[model samples]
Target: MAQTGIADRAARNGHAADEGGAGLAGRLLGGLARQVQQRIPAADLDERDPDYIRESLPRQWLLASLWFRGEVRGLGNIPESGPVLLVGNHSGGNMTPDTIVFTLAFYTYFGVERPFYQLAHNLVVSFPQLSFLRKFGTVAASPENSAKALQAGAALLVYPGGDRRSLARGLGLDRLFRLKVLPISLALPWGINVGDFLGHIPLPAKITVEALPPIDLREEFGQQPDLDEVYDHVMRLMQDTLDALAAERRLPVLG
Candidate 1:
């Protein structure tokens, strides 16, 4: 009789615990739904519009062909149909012209309908003037967002260094200096000295953007991956490519 009572008590406790866990999960899901609803419906760009991209192709073509004179290598490295992470070193300050060049080139080569997304800073997506970025499938950078994109069989472009880090490293400026002056220059109402502009006009820099071989995290790192090792590997690959490109350039803007 005592054993039966003890077992009954244990079962009751286990049932209570299950109920508590379900309640907590329900609350979390409810809160997540509310947060999603609160977000601006128009601003919630979870996908890309191929039609919009198609319409904008001409302008991108002009920029890639004439303005930046950008060249993309290693197109063959990208898998024909699968999730890919196009990691590259960003350049051209707050306004990453290299990103634009690469995006245009990628779409032109692959066509707009193919699932492709570029991860960018939250500020870029939130800015009023840059709303057009959403149309081009530029999503705010986040681990969750990236995972979702990959799961959906989309090719994702990510600059691991991000805006400040990439700009500082690419331009060879101290990270502290870039952080301090970048905001000041951006916030300046005068519009005379925008840090990103480089000068009154963008110096006609012959930017060469390269696409390194795609990395399948599952294949390379296995089920249990060491992220630090993966990060180091990717960085080394980009650094090597950048060194090669730098060597090819005869002059600063005239490369």
Candidate 2:
């Protein structure tokens, strides 16, 4: 209790000397976030170019088809209009083939004119080499950007992996954004790649994606349902789908 009081007082004091060495992390993360925000400004939403998407569809499709040999199903289940919350798993390190496949599928099915956005890591959006991703509606994964995309009636795709807090935030998103939670599953038979920068990647592998039926929070869960229950249900549903996908794989990347 004494230590707790000291810590509380330190926080209340808001002095670097009183931070108990907590200021380093805050400073580092803040600097990084600031640098990323500079590279990919909040106004980057306007960078979503329909013409660019239209022209790049063939290239993305070829990469998805010939390279990854990707296939997607149940995309029709998504509503034709309005905002949507696509929650799914992602793999393949920085060369995330699952996202590439899904991007092609979504653009072709919905048409380039439709507003669609994807939340990506700050590093991904901030990388100068990958700046073109912004043109494809890839925004830095932040609450403000997510809210803006939803407000713009854009379909938002999020891979809430390794972050239970993000997954739990679905409860608040449901209430505020009135967003429909669609549990999507993407399978990479190749498994995860650590994104080795020093060496070239091996031959392309197969990737399969499935968009499950949408979940209406109010209808599926009670009016004031428990967040934990919702999280468990979603997690279970995703895991089962992944297991089923894994079972079908006879080989690793060759599949």
Candidate 3:
């Protein structure tokens, strides 16, 4: 198009209008100047990362904590070293931020160096802008990939409810949901320790990450591998854990 021609010229020239002194910033500016001289920025190319970007967690942790404005409890419950499956309820809209916050908290409080690989939706890998999100060490939640991550001894964070639970029709509803059993199935076979992290969250409110006891998968894996049966079994176990935590919260403690 005619517009594309103009933009290309500008990018080639480096917008002299904005250039002052020739330096590192000037060189960078020059590249932009060329594009602006003729065409717009969009006419140029774009780059996106498909894996987790190395970011400043110290900064992100502060920002995310403030964003959620919630308290994180039972941080000590996370194992110092070992593979873990963090199963929690997902809220509609953006569960990524929530997971990021939880991931940062674990690193900040527990000093976890092992990369935390999360299960991403298939759509994320299909879209462009969303695909950028995939860069953050997230693998699609497919049977093969999930198994590989566990086998490789990587810590996994998943919201078993998936989109249906996280993207429920209502907002600011209940935070609890049944957990998925596949993760347990995968963990037990690999002898990976599983942790049931209870995120007792009230939307537009403070967040509490109650790290519960690790769920042993040895027994569950022995059963048939039918996904339906696995899902049901995991759901019951997760619900029981959540209920127990709720009861504990209700109890009065004497020091």
Q: Number of the top candidate by lDDT?
A: 2
Give model 2's TM-score versus the native structure: 0.78
Q: Write the per-residue lDDT of candidate 1 for residues 63-118, one digit (tens) a residue.
A: 66686677777666677666666666566357776777778778888888888888
Where does candidate 3 stray beyond 4 Å?
A: 1-55, 94-96, 110-112, 125-132, 162-203, 219-233, 240-255
Candidate 1 lDDT at 196 equals 51
The collision pairs in model 2 are: none
Instruction: Write model 3 residue lDDT over 67-137, tens digit each, in one string.
Output: 55534556555555555666665433433455655666655665434655666665444456555444545
- Against the unseen true structure, what C-alpha lDDT does each candidate score? 0.60, 0.69, 0.46
> Predictions ranked by TM-score, top down?
2, 1, 3
User: Against the hidden true structure, what lDDT does model 1 obtain?
Assistant: 0.60
Report lDDT (Cα) of residue 37, candidate 2: 53
User: Per-residue alpha-carbon lDDT of model 2 for 139-161, expressed as tens digits?
Assistant: 88766677777777788887765
Write down the worst ten-residue block by lDDT for model 1.
Answer: 183-192
Which residue pairs come into collision in candidate 1?
Answer: none
